[model samples]
Target: MDEWLDQLANTLATTTLREIHSVLKRAIRQAQARDMVLRNVAALVTSPTGTDGRPSKALTRQQAEAVLKAAEVSELHAYVVISLTTGVRTEEARALRWDHVVAWIPSLKTWHPVTEVGFKHRKFAIHVWRADREGGDTKTRKSRRTLELPKLAAQALRQHHTRQAVLKLKAGEAWQDHQLVFCTSVGTPLNASNVRRAFRKITKRAGLGTAWSPRELRHSFVSIMSDQGVPIETIADLVGHAGTSVTEAVYRHQLRPVITKGAHTMNTIFGDSHHG
Candidate 1:
């Protein structure tokens, strides 16, 4: 198996190798969960890092704006808004529950469920604590993070809440209460295919055609952040990678080696000495 795996490591691109490793690992974990295996031996193996593979596509800033504009009439509007702005994985977005949407109370200096407290002028955040994965954990420990919602996303969620309430009334007794942030009109959990089909429709409407995937929204997020001169390390944290190596390796093209945090920190400490 080691020799075969080594040969695969040599033959496959890095992204493909890592993805294969992940698939094998998750398969074993599920087997263990089902009591078919004693342990997840796949967890013991390190994911192979290889050279580049077929790189994924990301929407440019203009293209991303177009998608959002097109999503305005779609039920998936809030889903797309949050995914692109926060770089949340598709699974994470789908698994997001109402309880995790929180709002800060400046006067009380505490957080409350936005479902209960409602959105005001105060800051709001999403506790990225769960996913649709087995055992309901994020892909990695670092992937479990809290992020403040952008103003656009916050507004979308508020509007989405109103819209969902209307759906509940329309659904009547047929509605199921999974408390998911994103769900079907009948309140059933969303599957990948459903999201993909809806996303394609929105993309086609945006004049981007139907080939784009929902995951590309995440890639667009990383690209957009990198283009904004955010340090790779910060992008790594925001995207929930344990370190910057994956972010650097995966997004090398999107990261244009612009002014980094290193320069900003130095300038802050040195009073912009070079400018004089």
Candidate 2:
């Protein structure tokens, strides 16, 4: 089985190999349950690493700024803004509704409806409790979280809400009132493919030549926060990970070690001026 996997590895990507391995293991488990096999041999077989898959990439601060600027004028501006700034998964953002958006009214000292709150007197936030998956629940229980919106994200969302209202008036009875924050002009839900295509157009307009996807915006958020010295635990919570392990494993490349603090502390204590 290992030899067969090795042969297939030459023509497949690592992710594909892992999928095949998973299927085989399931089959073996079923066979064992049926008494057709004494044991699950597939579990003992290790999956061989296959051809390199497409490498994940995140935008630099300059590129992120450019992308945000370009997206601000695009039809998908709200989608881009919310995903990048809030670090919400693309599916979760697509599943978002107006009701899930809330505003913390400082004057009232409580959370209130975004529509009713005065923009200057409140802070906007998004509750990520659903997704575009089967059953509409989030990827994990821990993924259900509330994220505060940055000023830029809030501004984009406000403009988007106004634009959507206009679209609703134009559609009149033709509008499907899903109340989705990011949706078609007629208020229909957006699928992954539609978002991906739109995202590429936005990146192209921003002068990015490399292939990019909507999900990369979330990656950019993680990388930027990590580079700025945010702790892994905090990042995990922001990204809705069940634990730091998942965040570290999935975004290992984006994470920077926090070892600089110790060195800086030592340098300050000893008055060392030599650069490493």
Candidate 3:
């Protein structure tokens, strides 16, 4: 079985091999539960590493700036901005809903959703609670975090809100109204292909070519934050990474970084031209 698994790993892509391995492991576990197997042998087998996949690439500060510039004219502009600035995974950004967006009212001394109170303040945030996962939750429950928005991201979302209104009017009775931050003309959720195809166009317009995807936007966020002298621990927390001490302690506060230092850093970095 080990030899056969190694041969399968060599024959398939790394992701494909991992998916097959997971399926087999779960199937064997199920069989054990049904008393059809004496032992879950699949769990005992170590899956061999397949060929290395594409090396992860992160955009430089200039490249990131260029992508934002190019994205300004596209419908996916807000999506690009949110992913790149907030370090959110593409799936999390896709699953973002209007209600999850909130603003801190200094006068009211509370955080109320933008959908409830409107984007009328300097402090805006996103509750990163959902993803395109099977149960519509983040990869791990602890990964759910609330991240403050830089002024640029807030402006982009505001503009996106207006754009979605336009789309709703055009669709009329056909609009589905899921209230997703990014969606189709009829208001349905966006699929991976839709996001990739649109993001590639933005990257190409930025002179980066078609190789870039929305996930790269997240990579760029990490790259930019790290390059600007932000602490590694803070970056890890902002990106919702697990197994870190920062994340471990953060849950006590629901992982809400007061003032969202990362967002402030981002605001200072891209805050020059995009602020206006």
What is the full ranking by TM-score, best candidate first?
2, 3, 1
lDDT of 2 by residue, 1-276 (tens): 989999999999999999999989988998988999998877999999999987778888899999989887789998898888888888789988887788896677777767566355447888886453434553555456888899888888888888898999999999999879888878999978988988998999999964999988889999999988889999999998868999999888888876678977787887745655
TM-score of each: 0.75, 0.79, 0.78
- In model 3, the worst 10-residue window by lDDT is 247-256
Best-fitting candidate, measured by lDDT? 1
lDDT per residue for candidate 1 within 75-104, as digits (tens), equals: 999999999999988988998989899999
Residue 103 of model 2 has an lDDT of 88
- Model 1 Cα shift for residue 99 (angstroms): 1.1
Candidate closest to the true structure, highest TM-score: 2
- TM-score, structure 1 vs. true: 0.75
What does candidate 3's lDDT look like per residue over 99-122, in tens digits?
A: 989999998887888888987688
What RMSD does model 1 have? Answer: 6.0
Q: Give me the overall lDDT of model 1.
A: 0.87
Q: What is the alpha-carbon lDDT of model 3 when measured against the actual structure?
A: 0.82
Candidates 1 and 3 compared: the better one by lDDT is 1
